[model samples]
Target: MDGYVMRLNQFISHNAKYSRREADILIEQGRVNIEKTKANTKSVLLEGQRVFIDGKYVKPKDEELYTVIVYHKPKGELVSKKDDRGRRVVYDTLGGKYMHFVPIGRLDFASEGVLLLTDNKKVAQSLMESDLEREYIIKINGKITEEMIRAMNEGIHIENASTGAHQKSKIYSMTFAPFIRYEIGKNDIHFSKLKVTIMEGKNRELRRFFAHFKADVMDLRRIRYGWINLNALPVGKIRFLNKDEYKQLHQFMGKIGKIDSFISKNNI
Candidate 1:
């Protein structure tokens, strides 16, 4: 094959408005077609083959001229398209143009700050999985003790690191790398403030790390992702990546072909 070849479900998940699981369901229901022929869940798709779902033509993903945006996610907003419990989702505020964009990772419901979104799935996946620096400001209950500093310097590896994890999270064991950098802003007995930088975006990493120290994070806000900074962006607002930012992004993405090897060597 000289061009794109992928499973029918994967292609729908990437280019259509459905999750992989949802795509599988649609295929089982015989709602998807390729060149007017009914398709199965395990069907292989090739370049130039037309794909449709429920009689709606699926647009191919754009390889050129895509849009990226920075959203100042506010607290209490879920980083999802729809929440089953009627909780507010980012799309409720970012409706219309950005409705279909893929969010680059997530900021949990109670935590908020710089959230990135893009119309291109490849760009979103690259940025989400890349070993890029993420900076956050956190306020945790209790003092920033020597043990906390030592753990930040040495990192943590635990088999049951689920204290700060969501109840539904099945990921029990996790590997946290040494923080790239950390600085304490306050050291009060009741509460402390600190800024931390790390390359790993594992699930609720900060919450879990501080939880191991018996400190609960009260406030967490992300301020930066790699070269992209929140700067003066107000809460619940969205802005396009400036030309220079886009240039820097593409430059970073250009080197991601061997990203697994890169992450392995870098301890992200």
Candidate 2:
């Protein structure tokens, strides 16, 4: 307990072994240990303690660099590490260079655009929790009307499947619809394109929100996340965040001086 004592799940995740949720699973399965004793999800590790996962030693990762990359994720690739059906994932397409990088948030398999990958779990967690904005370029199968936009902005109630009684099932509902700042683009009679920005990142939220309006999203691409934008970077390629980009990202996360400390510690 000399330097930094971190929670077991955080330590496991920070080592680039697994996500915090996955670490909890490993701990609950009795696969994690410290000093030959079974570890719990809430267990804390001292500065110099060694951790073993599945009887294999877990090495500490160098957190000094805190590398972040902006990846132009093309459609058809999952943001997950491995897929049950063996479909191509972002890692599969990235090869071995970013094996330890974790996606900040996710873009569904069918959606494409700017994706942030990082080795630092704290930074990733911070960004996910922050009120950072994301911009998307979407194409829907029908003309968007002012009423639809107003309803979306005012919020809509959607059925909550998770909250229902057995048998006769008294189903409940939840209000969704984040404020959508949008600009419509001229398109063919069958479809219309929109550039929309939202602050929250709910699971398939944009698609579900549009579905409420009876507007099917034919194409969806996220062009921006926080201060990071998918400028001219070619799809399927990744580039490290430049100095300004890193600074701006940290600023958005309210983590000023973090980049400087990382650079100084790693001498990068």
Candidate 3:
């Protein structure tokens, strides 16, 4: 029964859209099976054992086959499945079709825009970990300072980027890369509006960046991620990547050594 052995949760996670953590919850709830018997938390799988979740048999899928959805997330919604504080989450608005999709990177509860969610774990993980540019339209409470422009152009290292961060954030320090580019919309003593592009997605990065200058990020919205744009997508709606978008993604992935890394990670 054992050419190679694996944990029940790992099997379900690799075979389905659920994460390893979500797979564990499914097993604990008695929703998974191995070799036609209900599985528990400690259940293990042999190389050839069959697995079923919710009455459907599943197996490892390595075809590079998957789907991506671009969602125009709205502010005030958490990126989580459910919130501990009972706040609305993206899933509540994302609806049933994308119940298990993994978000590429988070936009935080207060920010919104071209959020990418995919059914493929590898795609989601790869994109999130990549250094692709993220473009944003943001408004800060104070005028754009010359010092800020210098910092953006030359990049800056902060010992403790302390303010404007989420209360629960444990990130005390960060090194920000020079912005790819920036364009000012309006700047005055009242507030400054600008569009900036950068390739880092550290925790509450925009907020923290402005905070370092004693400015508050008044309104922050992401306009683009890599080659995908928010375009005319209304808030709280989702769309599939068009043919051109998929082609761009595929080409990018191919050059990014995606195939070899994915093969090695899955031990295929």
TM-score for each of the candidates: 0.87, 0.75, 0.88
Estimate, for each residue in 1-268, the C-alpha lDDT of model 3 and write its tens digit.
5476678776776567666788889888888888778898788887678898887888666647888899999999999877778999998898766766878999888888989998777788779988899999999998999989998899888889868778887878888888999999999999999999999766988788888998899889998999999999999989999999999988877866766788899999
Error of 1 at 210 (Å): 0.6
Question: Please, what is the whole-model Cα lDDT of each candidate in the order they appear?
Answer: 0.88, 0.79, 0.85
On TM-score, the leading prediction is 3
Stretches of candidate 3 above 4 Å error? 1-7, 10-22, 36-38, 42-47, 59-62, 258-268
Could you tell me the C-alpha RMSD of candidate 1 in Å? 3.8
Query: Candidate 1: misplaced stretches above 4 Å?
Result: 1-4, 18-31, 53-56, 257-268
- Find the number of clashing residue pairs for candidate 1: 0
The alpha-carbon lDDT assigned to residue 265 of candidate 3 equals 98
Worst 10 residues of 1 by lDDT: 252-261
Q: Please list the residue runs of candidate 2 whose C-alpha ends up more than 4 Å from where it truly belongs after superposition.
A: 1-10, 17-44, 52-59, 62-64, 160-174, 177-180, 253-268
Which candidate do you rate higher for TM-score, 1 or 3? 3
lDDT of 2 by residue, 1-268 (tens): 5666799887887785576888899999999999788899779988788999988888887654588999999999999877788899998888766867888998988889999988887688778866788999999887887766776578667785222112333534546655658787855569989898888755677776676667777888889898888999999988989899887765655553566578899999
